[model samples]
Target: MRVVVIIPSRYGSSRFDGKPLAPICGRPMVQWVYQRASQSSRVETVHVATDDERIRAAVKAFGGNVMMTASTCRSGTDRVAEAAERLGLGMRDVVVNIQGDQPLVDPRCFNAVVKPFTEDPSVKMSTLAFAIVDEREITDPKDVKVTFDENGDALYFSRATIPMGRDGFSGYTIYKHLGVYAYTREFLECFRSLSPGRLEEIEKLEQLRAMEHGHRIRVVVTPYDSPEVDLPVDIRRIEEKMAAMGIG
Candidate 1:
């Protein structure tokens, strides 16, 4: 099956306005994300799905493929679904939804998210999760926690800490959810048709809709932590990290 990476970028963001156009070094933030996604060997094609003409123009200026989606789309996943349909993607093709705000996302993370489906055809969708090493993060509502079964298929995802082990249960793991997602074209269409779930509404995580509907989400853990840019102060940290890694 052919794999395509679709990055959904909207100019308006509640926390950081015009985030996709934000400058990271010499290029816009979206460019960095597009470049990184393109580096993934598993992804056969990359497309940026955006509502703003400015974002479309910027992507085109960089010689990146872009699809103009309807502004009414509520979420990035929805935008990707529209793009996939517009592009005439087949049911067997895999669509990787790469977040536009994550400029530092490694190509390997994209690979990790999609690798499982190749091994098991039953894996309809998947995402990345990292262990929360910091104790402070365990209690942070902003950090979405996840727990999976022995087979590495996700059982649940919540903004609240999961597997609330009692009586000093130390060995149990706490994982923070990563925004990246890889889904078959068929599942994405199905996802758009389904209504939001209870835990999803409470946690405000759209992915939960999959779990609520009995769809299994395979979890892949990544070594590198991709910090999302939410505020202006985060730019310095991303710049520092990029500089340290010799990435311009």
Candidate 2:
């Protein structure tokens, strides 16, 4: 089955307005995401799925594919699902959801998340997680944390520091959940039909809806940590990282 990468973007955001088109190193943020996602060895195609015409135009101007989705779409996953349908993807095809905010995402992360389905035909959903090297991320709500079972299936993803020590916090390896996700087109349709869970609403995390419905999410640990842009202030930091990594 083919692997498709869809970057869902919106013009309006509570924190940062017009985030997808925001300039980072003189290029729209979505361009960086699209270009990096295209670099994936396993990805067959990449598309920007959004309801806003501005995003569509920007993507097209950069010679990238764009699909217009409904503005009423509930989440990025919903947008990706609609785009997948438009692309005529089959149930067994792999669909990778990469957020536009992650301009510096590593191409290898895309391959890593899609690897599970390649190894096991039964695998439906998978995501990337990076172990916390920065202590601040453990308590930062913006950086979602996750804990997985011995088999690498996610146990729970939360904004709070999980497995809190009764004595003191030390030597705990917290894993930060990356926004990148891969799903079988069949499971994506199932995900769209599933009702939102209480925990999902509380955490504001859509992945919880799958867990609440007894779906197993395989977590792939990647050495690369992709920093997401949540505000205008984060732009400088991204540019700095870009320079340090020798990325134009």
Candidate 3:
């Protein structure tokens, strides 16, 4: 099965406009994400899906592949689906959606996300989750939490702490959801056709739509932490991380 990585980028953002173009260590944030994704040994192709001319130009300037999507895409997933359709990918192929803001995303995580599909044919969708090291992050709305079944299938995703910690946060492992996702081309088309679910609307987490529709989302536990750039202030933090990692 072919594994394609699609990074959805837009120049407009309520928090940080033109975020994809923001420079980090002399490269645009989108380039950093694209470069890291390109290092994934499992990925056959990496493309930046965007509607903005500036973003397209930047991706081209870096000699990266890019596809123009409609500006009216409801979500990043929608943009990815559009790009995959335009590319004429087969239904059995895997399409990975990597967030453009994640400049420091681990390339190995790409391999991990696609493992479920290789090991089990039943896995139509898969995502990564990390053990919450900081207790404070459990309550933070910005950091989404996920609860999985005994089989490692996601039960629910929420902005609030899940499982309620009825025992006072002991004997339970809380997982923080990572933004990375891999979906079969068939399932991705099905996903876009489904209307928003009530739980998804309430939590504002789109992944819940699949669960609400009775589709199982395999949750892969990853040790890597995804540092996303949400605002301008986050640039320094990412740059510091790059410096510590000896990245030029």
**TM-score per candidate, chains pooled:** 0.95, 0.98, 0.97
- Superposed Cα RMSD, model 2: 0.9
lDDT of 2 by residue, 46-77 (tens): 99999999999999999999989998998899
How much lDDT does each candidate structure score?
0.90, 0.94, 0.95
What is the alpha-carbon lDDT for the whole of candidate 3? 0.95
RMSD to true structure for each model, in Å: 1.5, 0.9, 1.0
> Which candidate achieves the best lDDT against the true structure?
3
Residue-level lDDT of model 3, residues 1-248, one tens digit each, is 99999999989989999999999999999999999999999999999999999999999999999999998999999999999999999999999998899999999999999999999999999999999998998888999999999889998999999878667888988899999999999999999999999999999999999999999999999999887899999999999999999994
Ranking by TM-score: 2, 3, 1
Off by over 4 Å in 1: 167-172
Residue pairs in steric clash, candidate 3?
A: none
* Model 3 spans > 4 angstroms off: none
> Global CA lDDT of candidate 2, please?
0.94
Q: Please identify which of the two predictions, 1 or 3, would achieve the higher TM-score against the true structure.
A: 3
Least accurate stretch of 10 residues (summed lDDT) in model 3? 163-172
